[model samples]
Target chain A: MAADQLAPERDTRAVEAGLDALDGGGELLPPRPGPWQVFVRSVLPPVVFMAALVGVWQLAYVAELKPSYALPGPADVWQTFWGTVQDGRAVEAVWVSVSRGGIGFAMSLVIGTLLGLAMWGSRWLRAAVGPIVSGLQSLPSVAWVPAAIIWFQLTDAAIYTVVLLGAVPSIANGLLTGFKQVPPLFDRVGRVLGLSTLGRVRYVLLPAALPGYVGGLRQGWAFAWRSLMAAELITYSPSLGLGLGQLLSIGRDLSSMSLVITSIALILLVGVAIELLLFAPLERRVLRTRGLTTDR
Target chain B: MTQVREQAPTRNTVAPPPAPAAVRVDGVTQVFERGRPPVLEGVDLTVAAGEFVCLLGASGCGKSTLLNLVAGLATPTAGRVEVSAERPALMFQEPALLPWLTARGNVELALKARGVARGARRTEAERLLELVNLGSHGAKRVHELSGGMRQRVALARALAQDSSVLLMDEPFAALDAITRDVLHEELTRVWTEQQLSVVFVTHNVREAVRLGQRVVLMSSRPGRIVREWQVDIPHPRAIESPAVGALASEITAELHREISRHGR
Candidate 1:
């Protein structure tokens, strides 16, 4: 009886030791970075970089590198930025641009996903259209504005057309690249599990291709925003309201360099804000959850 | 090594009788490329229900290819491979668990594929996780688990397939010794409890002998079954036990002889 009892204890110990060894060596559970640590690492450096950039801009202004009328100092631009905001023009302009960009990006996402799946499904289609899609990515968003204006008559439809043309190819290519990169082992495993082709695409292929898909989404957003701005600047209608691009156009027409600089600053700020707020965090989470991110 | 002539080929020509087969591979040939030689040629084997069979051979023996054939991932160029169940669940050398999924989610996927309802999947997945001694770590991601734990989760996922046959391709080869030993014990207990017919592929002689009721040895180039040894050791066999050691050495000697045939 005692020997049997002792044997069970010994087996438990052996199992415990084995489990401990399993938990050893390549234990990649690095301590999660604290919020304060994240703030220092991610937020501080960019703030410092921006500060240095402003200092350089101020230095160039102080040195009188250009006439004040032609090139505004940081203070003049800052003053104009505040005036624009105080008059509520900045908020309206931001809302107009952001809403338009959001709608255009959503449309691009749907269309691109369909196109990508089609390309991935057939070698013939991929060969025929894959290069064309990639080529569209190299064609600047600004380049689509003239054709969009001709196609849709300088309305919001024209702006959306430009955004779609600029963004869809990028999103499609992202999905294609992601699909291509999915490990063959996953497909084998999926097959063993008896998942259907559609099921495999939904559960295995899409999740596996997320990093590239998200990368495409980020690029697509950038394209949509750029194309919207280009369209707004070139093809203005009273019904479109005061978009950021319209603000920039107005500043140029007024010949107030400070206003132009202020609008540019606001545009830059919005771009950075969207990336930091939406895409960067999304990409980081995707990578982190997959354990693809290392401390280095 | 003892030259026991009668016990050498323990298959049709020597062993008393064959049991009800859970898996049957008859004259199966696998050709990867048309111009090159076949990976496996004229291989014949049968695994009985509730029996643990180990396929042992040197590297490039097409042992993995044979498992893939049985898994239905690869179709043989000639002959037939049959499993008693719908399909056998395969465990690769690597865990091959979806990295994005938690341990429970990975197991749940198999159950889901098996058409388990959403409401019952959680409980079923939990039960499978408990079977592999990973009940507490079910929420952990694949990368969070240790290598051994990952394999255990994989075993649980395989279990979730609810298939009678389980094909493991050197599942514990990547693990440390202590972990491998523990896994061996766990596997034996689970195999007995679940009454599964397992075809475990490994290069380790001791692992084959320790775990298998029958060890099938294969030769390298154009892999073919060369010999078989029937191990009559009782259940709950320890890796370090004398019986296991003796059988392992015998099989190792046979394996080395098979390897030597290729060296020329």
Candidate 2:
């Protein structure tokens, strides 16, 4: 139809300015808490919870509910914990276990990502190996400790074997889940944009799958830590050296309740510290970039 | 308005089409699978260069299927679908912006796909964003944008492909009425400015009237073009204008007749 060309009722730039103002949130991003505020919010709650736990332990001791050998006083456990720290045994044990976990998890990450890509690329491989991978995740890594000890002779190899078994399945399955979550629309968008097959995977498919993949990595780390603890506790040869789990095992043999309690606490601390320092931040960043985080 | 199958229904039907054809679909029968009725059977539609055509239909009419054909996202089982230039840009019912990218980043990806050098992409992306009246909001992530803004960005992204034709599948169908109305004006302005051929698919009668130069009605159950109407009303046409309403009701009556057939 012969109509005069678009005559803007108002100046378009002015209109755009108004529209842009309204398009953004009235408050935009909520102000993040300052470092002090963050400390209070996060650190305070856990500190209070731990204090209450210690208070309960003190009450149990005051009541003399169990023999002193069976249930050590909270103060006695604390003193053992500090003694382990001062003697440098704590640092050495932490270093040995953490290094093993880190190396084992890295190998699993590479192998698991390749396996996932292969599974994605070929439907036959997916059909053949998909169910087994998922089943492996439910199978506790500790179950393999005896087998690994027999195969690798109760050394670092055995500990690493257990860690890899525990983590690889979760990492592989995480990649698959991420791939599945990518919408078919993305491929079509890729096609319409004239992206090649590799380009499609690199740009659209990979980014879409990232949130799920990070979730898998988080779960994998948890499994690796648990499995490493199980392996060290069970298959401690002289060659395997001292680790937090070996301390826990030694404490059990010696019948020192405070040492056993201290070892368990250190193990728990390592697990939590890794999560807080590494995986939590990584997962948060991935989800935040995709706007998948619910906290706006 | 005429229903002649022999020739394209242009404003001056007596004269041969003035512009070169942008798209030509000849007797395309798209049967997705064997042993099933075809979704689009013998559907022939032509879009001339720089023309704005709206395809009106009921659900299951293969409207989207046909657009997919023109987009080269699909192949016709029995006939030919041709586009004169490079692959046409396509817009979805949803904005389909990648959530991980900023609005400008999405457009830049399209530019990169077109083989625009890495050096020129940033400025080119900004220019396209400005075209859609979103120059200031290029850095905003997809989720940060509102529904209307997302679609506008989508339009900009489509333009980044630099395609001569644009195939839109109900691009405004998901918007609220007020937002939809505003988008009609924006689309009209963009269409006239770009002088690009658009194959717009929609079921909204007034939307077809307010935007398209020729509104082509289609039938379901093996989709076919049933009728065509040439809107004489001039551009900058208001959605609520009386002329748009008058023609819209006429098309609505025909659409109602088509829908009532499904009841049986």
Candidate 3:
């Protein structure tokens, strides 16, 4: 009876002790991967896949699948690529395309973000422009090249117009998606904290919307690069300078299959390089910080 | 059994207490949309400085709406709500900590919002985290911490605002029973230590009895305070203790009766 009477008194103390045991300095998250692990995960697989693809292409060449002119061997393509590299033509072609893509993408980012903010701020604006933006995202940038050339001529202006049309809607819609996904409770939290209207948008809304915006930027870059290539291919003139797409078109006029293949490979390589060097790291950092990455 | 007592009539225009109250809600009526019934009608509540009150009722009782009104997140449709000077800090059922920020960064954001200098912000955030027994875990991400720990960080962040009162809307309702019980003790300790006027809203009867100095029960359908109980239990009272259980059961019975009335 005495022990029974005392047991109830000890329950709270027992619970406190149990809680202390449970608290054990909290959970330990996995350590971030080192540079070598990053290389194995992100770099190695692509290198292996590309090497195997080239090997299969060489085997098909040995088997004599097509005429040597129509289907050039890997060695012929490599020789063409190497010659262009040695003559500095490759660097100039890549730089022209990259610089155009960079400039066009930057302008798109700014305009798209502003458009998204305007839409978020006003229901009328969102209703008016929202569907048009979605429709633009689905429309191929290649389709806009003819219209752009007619509007702005065969100068860089035509290429840039196509690039802007390709990228802006994707970026704006990305930001809008980000803003929409933000939980309503966050706004209430901001209000209770006495944050000013600008402060709430700056500190709460923008940060909440970042992951979506970054996804938008990545997609925008893809669209701009594709549109830039399409514009270059169709709008080539003597004064317009030789981009990768223009180099490929020149190869077509001269009937050099290997040169065309080399130019196409270079264009693909540059797109992959920009995505790997710039956007991949940025996207990883954003997702990791937000605990949206599964590795955490 | 402690029988339910009749609510005192609304006493607006009465002389103020010698010590100023932290919150004053006078005949608050909230209608979210036109031509619909009000969410809260003529609901009046007052919290004195350094007091702990729990608003207890079934779902749709406007307890959360009432807390939002007190927190100034939403304005009452008719009645005036007055907070004695400083803006009250509010906590939601979810932690609401920014996922981009670490637990410490979340607290620092609040300090920054309050215009705390950059030089002192870090140490002050640490001190607040320390107050919640999460000093060493401040560097962890929001996802890294356990559910109970996240709520503690939230409490720390709310404390960072340096508000006179804290409004909590079912903050611990999502946690497991054991964790909730542990948090109850942690909350009571912090409540006394901070000397904050707290208006805690919850549906749990025992939770109300465990932490509140006064438990106010509200009836739903244009929510109004129907009865109030002053918990005379001493400090550090266990949730399983007879005193808490007795008051909790009595309140639970009344709550059941109140809830049953809606079925008919």
- The collision pairs in model 1 are none
Stretches off by above 4 angstroms in model 2 are A1-20, A26-30, A35-37, B1-16
Per-candidate TM-scores read: 0.91, 0.95, 0.92
What lDDT tens digits, residue by residue, belong to model 1 across residues A60-178?
99999999899789998999999999999999999999998999999999999999989999999999998899999999878878887788887898899989989999999999888
Docking class for candidate 3: acceptable
Q: List the residue pairs that clash in candidate 3.
A: none
Given the true complex, what DockQ would model 1 score? 0.41
User: For model 2, how does the per-residue alpha-carbon lDDT over A86-173 read when each residue is reduced to its tens digit?
Assistant: 9998998999989989999999899889988899889999999999999999999999988998898878888999999999999999
Candidate 2 clash pair list: none
Interface RMSD of 3: 5.6
Q: Where is model 3 more than 4 Å wrong at Cα?
A: A1-44, B1-18
Q: What C-alpha lDDT, on a 0 to 100 scale, does residue A177 get in candidate 2?
A: 96
- Listed per prediction, chain B TM-scores read 0.93, 0.94, 0.93
Residues B109-150, model 2: lDDT tens digits = 999999999999999999999898888889988878878889
Candidate 1, true inter-chain contacts retained: 0.38
lDDT of 3 by residue, A1-296 (tens): 01122113335435644664576334555777899998999789989998999999998899989888988999999999999999999999999889988899998989988998899889999999999999999999889888888888889999999999999999999999999999998888888888898999989999999999899989989998999999888989988998888998989998999999999999999998999899899999999888788653
Model 1 regions more than 4 Å off:
A1-14, A17-30, A237-239, A294-296, B1-6, B9-18
Candidate 2 chain B: 10-residue stretch with minimal lDDT = B1-10
Error of 2 at B189 (Å): 1.6
